[model samples]
Target: MKVVPLGDKLVVKRLESAEKTAGGILLPDAAREQPQQGRVLSVGDGLMLPDGTRAPHEVNEGDRVVFSSYSGAEVTIDEEKLLILNADDILAIVR
Candidate 1:
């Protein structure tokens, strides 16, 4: 299944986090925090402005980005978990 976001919204898939800590201790699933990193899957054209102009998005498909915790909505596409976030929710793009 394919998802096409609209108006500065993006479809992102969360990247998996390490299960173990730096001390080589394994953390239980309940003890793990949700990952803030994700890969951009699909993007909308851009945001609409009141001036009748659109602002281009800084993010693109296949880009790794970091967003704020508790940001965006979660959806299940074809049984795969994905996030729908606004462009403004992204904090930084990973190099």
Candidate 2:
């Protein structure tokens, strides 16, 4: 299945967390936190402005981005975790 974000929204998949510590100790799932960084999978066209024009989004698909930790809605499709968040929730794009 494919996901397409609506206006001003984005479909992102979180990047994998570190599996091991610096000392090479493997970290269990219970010790890991949900990642705040993700890769953009799909993006909405843009936001509609009051002047009846569309404002282009700052980030595009395939861009790695950092977002607010508590933002967005999560969903699972075919066991794949994904997030749907507003473009505004994105803090920065990874270079």
lDDT of each: 0.96, 0.95
Pairs that collide, model 1: none
Q: How many residue pairs clash (N, CA or C atoms closer than 3 angstroms) in each of the candidate models, in the order given?
A: 0, 0
lDDT of 1 by residue, 1-95 (tens): 88999999999999998899999999999999999999999999899999988899999999999999999999997999999999999999999
Clashing pairs in 2: none
Write model 2 residue lDDT over 7-86, tens digit each, in one string. 99999999999999889999999998889999999999899999988899999999999999899999999999999999
RMSD of each: 1.0, 1.0
Listed in order, each prediction's TM-score against the native is 0.94, 0.94
